[model samples]
Target: MPSEGRTFIEEARRSQIIECAVDVLATEGYARASMARIAQRAGISTGVISYHFGGKQQLLEAVVSEVAKTATDLMMPRILAQTTATGMLRAYFESNLDFMRLHRKPLLALVEVVTYNRGEDDRAPGPYAEQHETSINDVIKLLDRGKSTGEFRDFDSRSMAIAIRGAVDAVPARLLHDPALDLDALAGEFVTLFTLATRRQP
Candidate 1:
């Protein structure tokens, strides 16, 4: 039982450090979000962060995972609640923008990390690349489902998926510039635009 207690405490500490890192990344950008800065934000020594995560890169990776999970948690329910492709598409755009509205900081941190974090081989960060590809594939599958169900017009699923994902992905940068931008308006516009693009004309 003692060991279990220690493990639980460690998990909580790790969560605290990750949350601090997210704030530092969101506010300072990736280039400036050094481990020491994150440590100071967490009110802990850098050694503690290093002990939990081997280095800055790992911590940033964890930040990406955490933010993505949070987004999924918020979005999947909305998406699943819909019964039609059009409804699902609407929910997808609405929920995504709503997430940005509710959790701007974590999304900004994720953008920073994905934009700047590179591996030792100078490759793009693995987590973002993998997650992005999976996102696209998920959209493609959704589009195909609509097609199979005769709910959507005939179009290239992959292309439409890419376009949809691109539209959603562009929001983070826009938010950085226009913090007060009407995301609800934007969300409605996206739903209208993509729904028209994909839905079969009766």
Candidate 2:
């Protein structure tokens, strides 16, 4: 058994490694983010990285889980507080845009993971797929709530969730490829598209 202080220190060190791993992966890509590089970025030794994560894949998974938790932590409260579906949907898009702007590195890593796994079996039990599903479920629940309140048209929430998510994901890709793209203008377009798609008929 470890001393309480030592346990806390170890956990802190592990957290530091996890954070550094994300940075390294984002900057260097998964294929090049070696334990040594991650430790160098963390100001720790390779042994420490190995002690905490056991290997690269484990560290990548932890990074994915951390990124997903961070995204949820940022958005879930606003989502839970909304009394109307339209409000919830607006909050959802705004939160995603805000998150992408503030957390660019993790979002970049997320994009990389999605592109890498584009057509693969995403059903496998892993952090990437798990995070994807969590985000989708959150949107679906909000849509269902909106429909229940007669705020949105009665459409399949799951399909609508996919469309909304696709738009959110595509924004980053477009911005990445074209640095001159105006995100504010794109966001306005997104809002218009979302409203038009979900707006209830008169």
Candidate 3:
């Protein structure tokens, strides 16, 4: 029970640090979000961060992972609940936007980390990049499902998926610039735009 209690406290501290890191990353950009800054935000020492994550790169990876997991947990259910390809597509956009709207800080942090953070070898893509590739692949599968079912017109699934991903991703930067932008309306526009693009013409 003592070991279990220690593990719980450690997890709690890690979560707190991750949350602070998200805030720092969102506001300061990844390059400026040092361990000291995050530690200050968390009211803990930098050594604590190092003890938990070893370094900034690992902590940034954890930030991406935690945010992505939260988004997936929020979104996958809505996407999975849909019975039709069109419904799934609409849910995909709506749920993604919903998550972004509700969790702007985490999304912003994710954007900054994925956009600017790099690994030891500058040429190699990082974990966040790999996660994005996985998301694109998932969208391709969804598009293929729609095409197979005749719910969507004939088009290159990869191309359409990439377009959709780009549209969704461009939102965070937009929000960064215009915090008052109506994401609900924007989400509606996206659903309509992609629906028109993919749906079979009457």
Each prediction's TM-score against the native? 0.92, 0.85, 0.90
**Residues 1-202, model 3: lDDT tens digits:** 3233468789889899999999998889888899999999999999999999899888988898899999999999999999999999999999999999889889989988878877767887786987898899999999999999989999999999999999999988888889999989998999999999999877
lDDT of 2: 0.78
The numbered model that scores best in lDDT is 3
Worst 10 residues of 2 by lDDT: 117-126
- lDDT (Cα, 0-100) at 153 in candidate 1: 95
Of 2 and 3, the candidate ahead on lDDT is 3
Alpha carbon lDDT of each predicted model: 0.89, 0.78, 0.91
The prediction achieving the highest TM-score against the true structure is: 1
lDDT of 2 by residue, 51-86 (tens): 877776677777778787788789879767877778
| Residue 163, candidate 3: alpha-carbon lDDT | 100
Tell me each candidate's RMSD, in Å, in order.
2.5, 3.6, 2.7
Give, for candidate 3, the lowest lDDT window spanning 10 residues: 1-10
Q: What is the lDDT of residue 52 in candidate 3?
A: 90
| lDDT of predicted model 1 | 0.89
Writing each residue's lDDT as its tens digit, candidate 1 over 1-202 gives: 3233468778888899999999998889888899889999999999999998888878877888889899999999999998988899999999999999999999999898777766555854555877888899989988998998999999999999999999999999999899999999999999999999999999
